[model samples]
Target: MTVKLTNIRIITCHGEEVIEKGEVLFNEKGILDVGQRVNTDEHEIQEIDGSGLTVLPGLIDSHVHLGMDSSPDPFANMKNEGPEDIAFKAVQQGYRFLQSGITSVRNLGTRYNVDISYRNAVSVGTVVGPRVFAAGSPIVMTGGHGHVMAIEADGCDEVRKAARSQIKAGADLLKVMATGGVLTEGNDPGATQFSEEELRCICQEANKASKTTAAHTIGTDGIKNAIRAGVTTIEHAYLLDEEAVELMLKKGTFLVPTLLAPRLILDKPGAVPEYMIDKVRKIIADHKISFQLAHQAGVPIAAGTDAGTPFNTPGLLSDELALMVEYGMTNHEAIYSATLGAAKAIQKETEIGSIENGKAADLIVVSGNPLENIRCLDSLVYVFSKGAIVHHAPVNKQEKQEQIV
Candidate 1:
């Protein structure tokens, strides 16, 4: 059905320009146009009076784990969760994100290739959720970071096989653990897990299959090694030093900073793993600082929340943009990171990032101007996914009359 959203303010991330009295014209296929006073027949069109709302390209989360649920005590859940249980929970989480206005996401890890299956389900209309690009499983050394969730493979040959397994399982990209993680049993978050040669081999294998790689690295050395090995994106460079920052700038690698991950684990008033608490305390300060270094050096910073991790809510990726603004980015820059910058990170820039006429009409309407206040994203008034009005916030009694013109 054709629809026209009129009398709204549009923040087009194409160049961070704002259009007054903007109209978004769309149909089942995609967006038809976005501009001021778009000429359309009012009689047949479903006209939405968005006089008090602001429109933006639906937010994109470049890094998230859908299979895990992000309650306060996620350690127990991840430790004992079964595949069927995780799958069921993921279905709920995916829709929750959609209702919360996240239109696209990248799942970096999951148990039993569930992420790939979820993505496929969304594609085939068996399930309804946002677009998902998944890494079926991550590659980790035996007894290293995320050993439980990842495929354990050591050495060059084993690493290559691991990469192939994720690709074979239908991963859009390959995720490799370049360093040990804090939450894993008997692992040090500050130590490197994979050798440079093994990391390079995995990248080579992924490249041969025409897939990109995301490195889960926390230590400075591990971040450097992953950059030298030519990984496509670096996740959680919490301890990035000046040298590591220099390498990222040199390689032109984008950093997917899930800043909310550690903060959530550290601040939650519940029983977290002792190791996790300690790790967050030790690294939280530097984690905040690393984003500054990358932002200052002009390294592309994309908005991602390690959702499904301990206390990192799935639909709360918008909150990360607020944090990004607080940390150093302007409101427009923060919004751009989650929209266009994230699109570029996933190599979908030509398709889903901007408000182009031919692009998919995955967009959201907030209660206020997000370009003025980033937190406005948390108050999404409407969510239009692929030209369908999937969600609309409840209107107050006083505001109901506004819907009738």
Candidate 2:
């Protein structure tokens, strides 16, 4: 069905511009037109009067683990569930994200290749969810961080083979555990897990197949090594220093600063293992400072909540954006980081990042202007995914009549 949304404020992230009192025309295929006035007859198309609403491109999350439940101790919770149960939960999480206005996401790591399966299911109409860019499994060193859910490869040759294996499994991108992590027991978040040579090999293999590489880098040295190895994006650079920030700017590498992950871990103390809590306490202050440094230095920062990590639920991108604003970014910059910035991180900029003609109609309508109050994103009125009204808020008869002109 063709739909025309008129008299609304548009946060078209094509540039630093907003179209006030404009109309957007779209159908099942894609966006047909968007400007001050749509060039089509209003009689045949369904018209919606959005007088007090603001429309913007749907939010994108660049880092997530869909297969894991977002409990306080997801690792312990995973042991009780079987593979089928985990897969079912993953699907439910995807829908929850969509309902919360996230139109696209990148699953950086998951067990049993469930992320890839979920992405395929969505493509074939077997399920309805956000656009998923899946990484089948991360490549990690033996006994490295996330080795249980990842493919353990020690040497450079093994890393190359591991990269190819993920590609064979229909991975949209390749992720490498370049440094230790907080979740894994006895792992040092400040220590490097993968050497420069192994990381370079993975990057080379991914480059051959035209796939992007994301590095789970936290330590300063590991972050620099990933940058030098030509990784596309770095995740969770919690200990970024001046040199690391400079290297990122020089390499034009994007940073998926999943700020919500560590904060949540700290907030829900005693909910997780003591090791996890200690690790977060040690790095929480530095993490915020690193993010501020990256933002002020103009490093490309994408908003990702690291959903499925402890209390970091699937629908917290708004909170993540609000945190970014609290750190150093303006409201518009925070929104851009979640939209166009995230699309660029996953190499999907041409399709679903912004509200433009011929792009996918993945958009959300909120009650107030997000640019004025970023928290308004939490109040979504409608969600249009690929030109379909996937979610619509309930309203009274009189309110509905006034909205659906």
- In the range 45-140, model 1's lDDT, one tens digit per residue, is 888888777889999998988878777555456668878887898799899889999999999988888999999999898989999989987888
Write candidate 2's Cα lDDT for 258-333 as tens digits: 9889988888878889999999888989999999999999999888988988888788999999999998799999
- The candidate that achieves the highest lDDT relative to the unseen native structure: 2
Off by over 4 Å in 2: 41-43, 79-81, 395-405
Query: Each model's TM-score?
Result: 0.95, 0.96
List the global CA lDDT of all models.
Answer: 0.85, 0.89
Candidate that would win on TM-score: 2
RMSD from true fold, candidate 1: 2.6
Q: Which stretch of 10 consecutive residues in model 2 shows the poorest summed lDDT?
A: 396-405
> In candidate 1, what residue range of length 10 has the lowest lDDT sum?
396-405
